[model samples]
Target chain A: MKNAKLRLETCLSPAMYSKHANDDNIVVVVDILRATSTICTALHNGVKRIIPVSTVEEAKAKKDEGYIVASERDGYVLDFADFGNSPFNFTADKVKDKEIVYSTTNGTRCIHMAAHSKAVVVGSFLNLTALANWLIGQDSPVLIFCASWKDRFSLEDTVFAGALAEKLLASGKFETICDAVTASLDLWSLASPDLNGYIQKAAQKGRLAAKGLDDCIEFCHQPDFTSVIPVFADGDLVPVS
Target chain B: MKNAKLRLETCLSPAMYSKHANDDNIVVVVDILRATSTICTALHNGVKRIIPVSTVEEAKAKKDEGYIVASERDGYVLDFADFGNSPFNFTADKVKDKEIVYSTTNGTRCIHMAAHSKAVVVGSFLNLTALANWLIGQDSPVLIFCASWKDRFSLEDTVFAGALAEKLLASGKFETICDAVTASLDLWSLASPDLNGYIQKAAQKGRLAAKGLDDCIEFCHQPDFTSVIPVFADGDLVPVS
Candidate 1:
């Protein structure tokens, strides 16, 4: 391991960073189901830009200026929005030159929480390898901020964090800072090589399935399906410059 | 293995039960750095009873009644207090038959947080098996409240929580409820069997040793050295009732 001294906090809630409050490291905010996944998909599919706002009002305000408004609440697309959290919505044709002002329940809120970090990158399974490679390229400490479900620990986020950690570990950097990170890696180790199969069977995925959002689950589990690394700069998540 | 349906959130913090609190299972509060270790040593050696109070004022009130006052601040014994957080201070000669009013930085606060729990048990490496067996006897869910460092995740507390999860898993009814518990159990698997060796070289233990607290480190790592399971009931921690 590279011993990069990373801090992997398990949630995107304000409560997680309210105590640590470090602005020196790279903060990769992950909301795997499905804001981050959607963002990576949009950017990867040639979306002009993504304006990640903290609230629906801000997104709506941007909408009046001709930006496509994408908002989701509780994992469902709001009736008035042009798009929801599905990756399929971000195909090349739909968002080729569009600017998306987006807001979601947990992921966007995490971007706000980590806005002050030295570098903020959006991460999901779709951009896992790219995010890890970028993190390893930097000497600064990395923090994997999991946008947990409603401020509590969620399996999917931690699993993504573990996958990230596993990749970083493969590069021989990034010491395990906390037991949670080590535990996450352990879970990831138990997972089959087919990452999508494992996530589709996860507790969070099961809950989504029960709610009849199996398509969203499949979309969220697609690994390396996108190559975009959404970096937050000046309060907006744009393509890494 | 027990399939007891153990929930990790219930174990990490008592705040989870704020809305629908259930005082059914045993709540194990762990502050492995010193508080719980000190209490375990105190009760094991011969302290008649230790009353864990939430605030210094409450501790002082108990002290006014002629009880021995033990208080800690910033991981050290407070000035004008009878003792700090060292387990060595809890020898049979010092605390035997004495009423102790105990207050520490984090452990007591956790005890108070878990006041609504059906039963609160103080757990540490010193009495891991005793605590686990008592929890197995109970019909309710076991909430292992890791009294983290100032309410943030601390490595020591998580390791202790992991140890508890490992023990529970061995009994064959404890079903992992949340990611946190599963993570803790995974950590336990990596660190146990030679827990003392693990702790002796842990980052926190190394820091403590630098401060000339190696004795406390050794004391805290003594697994199953004391068979006493201290149960918190009626505001006092006594042998499990």
Candidate 2:
């Protein structure tokens, strides 16, 4: 039987997914801005574990238990937190063998919204190829849930979703049901073979540049910075072992 | 001072204006899937007037006053209505001096959402060049709100938005603020001078083909079918005149 997988790329917000809660499929939550990038970097640097809580209070509670607290809000690190959203904050020596409690503005909320999904995988550009391969192997429909900024669609996240969808279609692993998904694939195809340049010159990156955050944009655009697949299991973002 | 006018090709939703709702701007709503297309056809063909109500009941209530209820739900024409959503249904001879009470799944809702905008124009491929020229002459930010399928993103609508945005950029009339909109412009640039073929082979059109609705897609893709600009004002759709 052909796998009847449904892929949804959504920005992380309660408003985006609340309507589709009854959907029975795997939801891949993506927050490419800095959350997923930060998580991928931390894990690749040998962070033993990450407990992704939904609130700053929960992060603090976990910190009281002696875990390193990594939290961000409004694109900046909380004053008392040990880490901010920048991928550069997580280095190999700093995170090796250390468990951390983490939270973020949009990505964590997305994981919570997809808590009822059959499987929820944390996705970002860093592991795009691996996630695409894993989605093809799945027996269920795939939902590329983009954690869009707040509840609105983010260009980078949607493009990332489109890029993944394009890969899946090129691999001939699944069929697309939505025009948005297919159009996204078309957009990706047009930008393919030079996706990094595409990202650097994109509107979101430009905005960050105007705000003097080009470093963060460059860090997020780095491809295959890690091979770790972060899966939201039992309310925690653990590396796919 | 540089004219910081934003163009439609780069962004295609109300979300793009979320950060600048109070900014002086003109928004054009596009829904090629029958609403804007139908409206353009109706006005061009001699429909004396068109009242775009928000709900089926509102359309019926207007119909009770002897207006022709041309309503669509779920992309299908409701029974007991004088017309469905087909632009062909609104030819000059048929709609001459007629008052149409129209309601649709998406387009009208977008009109309502943009009711407070400085100016709201209905756009489609049917009037692509004319709309682009008009946008260039305006000083306010131009927002192309794609009346996506039932509030979800739709490729056909966004692509049309992208095309309009591309035209504005080429005319040197607007600056893009949002990343998604800029990406859309880039996507449009890559696929330009061949949009007709692009839309025909797009995923949405593919789905329509699967359902044997290729005729509708072909009809919707017809360019410059009408030169009239349909503007939403005073709770009705009328020619810009």
Candidate 3:
């Protein structure tokens, strides 16, 4: 008998992850409004590794150990962090060849949530194509896990999950019975024509814009902006180019 | 200053309810594939009250106490249940003037999740207008909580939330910063033209179809099929009409 098609599912929040978790699936953790995007950009710009911690204090302790830290909460940089949750903050000058401890209001925590999966990978539009290609080659079921805002569903991460699910479904290698995946694909179709205009209404968009940190909003939604895929390995996210 | 617009939000799953929970919000628990639809139908047909229990044992205990039970798990009628999770099974002949002890895989569990809210109401496309009109007069924030399938996002419930939110927002009496609400509105727009066709792709559609229990699929999507709004009071869901 022919092998069953690989299943592709989109989990809209970390709070819902327990239902979708599987030891055999490759978990793609996405935080489109910037944590995963920052990880992709940092790896693409030659950062050695990213150590994702769930708590701000953990990132702070890593800072005390002289490791650079990138932290933010509620759309603002923490007072003691070297940088906030922005892709531009991870450019080569600061993060290159250095191990950075990262924490955010949502995303890094999701990485920890998926820490027990067989494989955990960071995803954003910046690494969309590369990540999709890598996932297709893995020959396992895929679960696109969105690092939703504060364990509540967030639009941008889910939209990105739709974009990635669309690609995966088009490859003829995946099948899904997940309503979240189907709804997300529908959302992707609606949002793809004008991502910027569509995302302007997102709650986080307004929050980030108010803090003048939304400059990366469009950049974060730009598919294939980078070729690096950040794979979780040995307690750090390292580039898989 | 004018009073703030009444907040409208969608809680996509019972698992995510804690983050969106507030004593100030009126919670509308939805289980669109069947549970809430059944509740609306039962009440419209003159069922005295519904006692929703979260577990099969509780429902069985209620049955032992001589109350009629309506129960299902997955997509079939439980061996001990007099009726399954289908609205058509709830006719005046069988259910009128009777009190039902109801339990289902997802919906009943969700009702308990919102039991502590300011008010817990039942909603489905069957009672869409009556519920919305009643909510307009309540002068309170509304949380449309979807009884998502097994703690994961389910498409039909979210689309129904969008339909209700559209009505609530149209009254010009409500506002929302919730991304889940925004996304649901988008889904409603996409699905409204062909709700049956759109929902045909839902996983539960296949589940119910396999059991020969999806005859009410179209009826479940029919807006305003009943005017009874089931409101939780004391320990039972009594008709508010």
Best TM-score goes to which candidate?
A: 3
Better candidate number, 2 or 3, judged by DockQ: 3
* Residues B102-134, model 2: lDDT tens digits: 888677777887788888889988888888888
lDDT of 3 by residue, A1-241 (tens): 9878998988998889899998888999988888888889999888898888878789888989998898887777888899887888888888778888888767767777777888999999998988898898989999999998889999999899999999999899999999999999999999999998999999989888899998999899898988899998988899864
lDDT of 1 by residue, A157-181 (tens): 7778788888887776566545456
Best by DockQ: 3
lDDT of 2 by residue, A118-229 (tens): 8888788888888887877775667777776656556677677787777777766566656557656666666567777766655556655665556877668666766788
What is the C-alpha RMSD, rounded to one decimal, of candidate 3? 1.5
Per-residue lDDT of model 3, residues B151-209, tens digit only: 98889999999999999999999999999999999999999999999999989899888
For residue B166, model 3's alpha carbon misses the true position, in angstroms, by 0.3
The local distance difference test score of each candidate is 0.73, 0.72, 0.89
* Lowest lDDT block of 10, candidate 2 chain A: A5-14
At residue A87, candidate 2 shows an lDDT of 76
Model 3 has an lDDT value of 0.89
TM-score of each: 0.84, 0.90, 0.97
Residue B6 in model 1: shift from native, Å?
7.5
Alpha-carbon RMSD of each model: 4.1, 2.9, 1.5
Stronger candidate by TM-score (1 vs 2):
2
Can you rank all candidates by DockQ, best first? 3, 2, 1
> Which ranges in model 1 have alpha carbons more than 4 Å from their true place?
A1-14, A53-67, A136-139, A165-201, A214-224, B1-10, B13-25, B54-65, B166-176
